[model samples]
Target: MSLAEHVSQRAEKKESSMTQQTQDTTTADLAAGFAAGLDPREVAEAVLSRIAEREPVLNAFYLHDPDQVRADAAASAARWAAGTQRSKYDGVPVTVKENIPRAGHPVPSGTALANPPIAQSNAPVTDRLLEAGMVILGSTTMPDWGMLSSGVSSLHGISRNAWNPALTTGGSSAGAGAAAAAGYGPLHVGTDIGGSIRLPGTWAGLATLKPSAGLVPLHAPYLGRAAGPLSRTVAGAADLMSVIARPDARDYSTRPYPQMDWTKILSSPRGLRVGLQLHAGPGAAVDPEVAAAVQSAAEMFSAAGATVVSVAPFLTQEVLTGIDAFWRTRSWADYKALDEEARGSLLPYIARWCTGGKDYDGAATIQNYQRFGQLQQATREATEGFDLVLSPVAPMAAFGAEDPMPSNDPDTPMTHISFTLPYNMSGQPAATINCGFTSDGRTIGLQVAGRVGADDDVLAACAWYESVRGDAAPDWSRVP
Candidate 1:
């Protein structure tokens, strides 16, 4: 055969592999459905129907246009029919968080502080997803400046738990979490600086990953900030990760990394060194139920022949307080830039929290900066000897939908993030998988964190845990 024929044959075989599957909206599923001649318009309509059913109570989106969704699906269907589908994910619907820009869409930044401008271009990750032929559903909602760890947003209104509408879906990826749990579609892209993605992953009973800082490209990369995937299953999250992590020249920070074989992201936990952390050094005490769930999951590893050891709390109040101080300074700068009316539109809770930036002198600000470094060093030291650490994703289950955070105190908003924050600064890859549930049916998350740049292993460990967790995983497809 000619070279061109060989390449075409390869593509055909690859496409054929995705032909037999279900209609769950997972990338694999959608790809299979498409290969079987399933109309992309039908998939779009089903997802829209789901959104209509869930949106009124969940408030899980900032921009959800059925017209736009239909348009994108039509384009994907055309590509598939022409045998020029962008990638294996063609026709799969996915939602982008409001803060992550898609060309021509306004990034609201999760606050009512001002009318955010329409982005003139796409964030690198967004471009990659579009290139892969994933249909964009719309932008999801988040809390003010993504500062709070709950669903109450000043601009987008409050997003609620998918499991129970009265409860909050953890923020700033609030809408993504709710959408995933409600099965609005297969993929939900979110960004996390502290615990935004995983907190919501836990609260909403989803699988999510916070890749190493530079592993997934971001437009304006900053310390600890990363773009990642949130989905109902690890396989779904992995499908999105493989695409978003593709090299992009715009984000120079995403460089010099070996190509990953995502198929290898499922391994046995046997013979692996594991550390168990029930208490985050200083923050909200893990509720008894939450702690028990984590502990039980850890014991499963022990039973599976993995060495499990308890690690001492490594965080300090000084570091937590200082990091908050630095963030206060950053947000305050943004607040000061706004005109009087725009500033007045800011969320009062966040305003009360970060306004103290004015009080910090140069020396104090430097001191706060030092605290962030201390946190980075301390987190590294705490998880140094272990291959992976198992911990509770949150102190408790979802809180009231209207509360700004789990603590309900702006002064101490970082309280629930202790378990998941350290990995962000250390640039370690961490994942959240449902290990158990609260007494009332809310899900509890088991955090699997690997060393810095160990994204694949972190995912593998999460997959291993999920396999062993058995029926504990929620039937999101069938769940209400």
Candidate 2:
């Protein structure tokens, strides 16, 4: 039978009582439900129903197949009912980014110009998640080529923040953030090159971890390496990371790290040195409320017996210039290859910058890479004594949906990098936690970054902060 027909058959067999029970349970609660003999298929059906009802307005999902999800869920249910649930993520529904390949799923990577056929095999990370028993609901939206920071995309359209759909949800993992924040799914897999994962988490009031470069594999169909989770809590993010963190033969860049037991290690946050820095460069423009929220989080850490110190050596213009040059130079080939129609379809700012191709020369590219290396070294030196660094996740909360990012300033401009990209360049592990809310009711995030191999420390710090300041649960009532 066709995929749609398969889904219809399963939907027909779904019991009303089972639907009610699954609909009422949280993602964590659903895991508990499976533990209690509840059917995984029922849970998956309820999740698909929730997404069907909510996605039309949210625009979070780019591709979905209810039949495939039902089949996977039924298999998971059988495993759970037989006392053989394979992994920690058993029965959980997750949204995968378009850039990550899932066998038989169309992964256009958000480019309207190119419609690559459905993938023939799963990306290594996707395989890991499936092996761990998670059900894939659909692909989430992201920027064309994953180049821009704003969540607007020509291929899948804009993914607005869940708190207020009128505002931007941040990108390139835009739709993943919206889905998690809107409760379309409890877990979302996203990529980060610039502020992709953390920025969206900040705007949508979700938790996210941009694992240290190489912690998660990035393979075919994904040009750059990035795979992380967007979720309602830090522990949930950690759990997803643990499942996808193993080294894969497909990705030569995958780092060798001990497999983490998240439940055991992240049970409580203790013995961590936290450093707070609001300014990263000479002209870092930090929104007053955002800075205040970050400071308040630091104070909470102090009260929780963690050392909080103000550190300088913030992100400098030189550092940003170098990073920008690196991206332009590295992605130059890809931009040039795009046909005019595809080029025309991109967000204007992205099209302008990406297509420019004249800013940095070969020598400049190498120099920028060298300069970035120095900055990474400097960051490591400055943060040597600390276990984690705390700061605002973004310069401000979600901007208006119509005007996603400022477009005028280009050279050494003081824009939204106050909280994000530095960590990306540094290749350090970073996470965003819901620190508080703006007066306008939009969410604000506090960023915690750890050293190269300190992914667990970052997760633990977020967990500590969450314990003191409770998690900001998504407002389902506002979900469209």
Candidate 3:
């Protein structure tokens, strides 16, 4: 039988469990409630209360305006009452990563830069969410400059994992994942250049998509940064994607595609080709449990009639060289732009990274771009036959909350993010779906990536995995 058929049978056997625990304001659950005459104000209040009760532990929000949120919720409630709801997201609460601009909000991007100017306009992603009527709950946290994969942000302190406060919540979309895991609300916007979205999503037991670069237009100064959703359910991510991926003239990088119903893409997984990629490169070492979880995900896909094959590492030296030379160095140039006083205010490690970017001269920058082109082409050739690629989101599990990166890595601080950065270099679509948990209860994410402009296919593959892999949802009762 097909995967959809199996899901139907499973659904029949397992009666829908909308327990009180499951009522933690997921996108789908909130939408259904709003459609059924639920009061948007009440939903907003519950979310605010949860944030207030949990903020001390999670540190999920950098800034949240409760009064503004209530006003928006009141407007949304009025719209639903008049039978004029904007969309399925009309009353659903959502969080935006701190780096992404929202009108009248502070865009700290997790830094101690003194009294930064407030945003006077909405980012395209934020505009789209507001247009679709998603109630903005607040802004989530991220590492300073979004450079690290761990949750140590000097500006916001450290964001603790919802699963375990002692462990780090992987970043730079740190608070988005923590908020989702902590049951703050359903839909959240997260930016991923490297593994920001996927790493945090997995570590916090949430579903996330690093949509194709140019899939969701972003305001980042460099390439490879894309804004996408983090949610507890694949359906929620799909719904948010449909809204935010809409074309915007402001974002020159956005690749325009005809509006498609992304939700319908998950119907079947038969006759699909899936490649299982374990190691990112020679030096990258994956945790045994993470590899096992990904392996199990591959087996589930194969059982669902998809052709699953183990693939060799395709991230070549050229690709690695390009990403390191162009992306990271160029990113540090922004910090390099800051005055010495502002730079001194930055976290010491962030200042170190910025200082390192000074070594790349003009000739090297141009050469890196050329190498970037070659790497993109090579990545295209590498996975030509596969509809999707399956891999581990991070090489290791969540480490200490205060640590910048993993503890054992002596040579490079970026090893944990190795698996997820190649897609950024190639500008392809990738996602992290929670596959299982570690013995210590850290969530494990299995990545699904597809060719550039094949975001729907990637989302479909994730939806398929979630369907077949029963128990994809986190236990909200355990949330902080």
Top-TM-score structure, candidate number: 1
Error of 3 at 78 (Å): 1.4
lDDT of each: 0.83, 0.74, 0.78
Q: Each model's TM-score?
A: 0.93, 0.89, 0.91
Flag clash pairs in model 3.
Answer: none
Candidate 3 to truth, TM: 0.91
Q: What is candidate 3's CA lDDT for residue 245?
A: 87
How far out, in Å, is residue 165 in model 3? 1.0
Residue 252, candidate 1: alpha-carbon lDDT:
74
lDDT of 3 by residue, 1-480 (tens): 222223233324322222222335456656666776766776677677777777899898898889989999999999999999999679778899988898887887888888876998889888888888888988899988788777777788899898888988889999998888777777889998778899888788778899887778776535667889998888778888988887778888777765656866665667989888888783458989889988988888888788988888766655565556665576677876888888788777766655666678888888877865675676677778899889998877788898877743322456576678778868888888889878777888988989878787788778877877876445667765
- Give per-residue lDDT, candidate 1, residue 246: 77
Candidates 1 and 2 compared by TM-score, better number: 1
Candidate 1 pairs with clashing backbones: none
Candidate 1 ranges beyond 4 A from true positions = 1-25, 265-267
Model 3: lowest-lDDT 10 consecutive positions: 14-23
At residue 170, candidate 1 shows an lDDT of 92
Q: Pairing residues by index, what is the TM-score of model 1?
A: 0.93
- Runs of candidate 3 with Cα error greater than 4 angstroms are 1-25, 265-268, 407-411, 471-473
lDDT of 2 by residue, 223-294 (tens): 224689889877778878877888888887777876655654444344568788888764447788888888
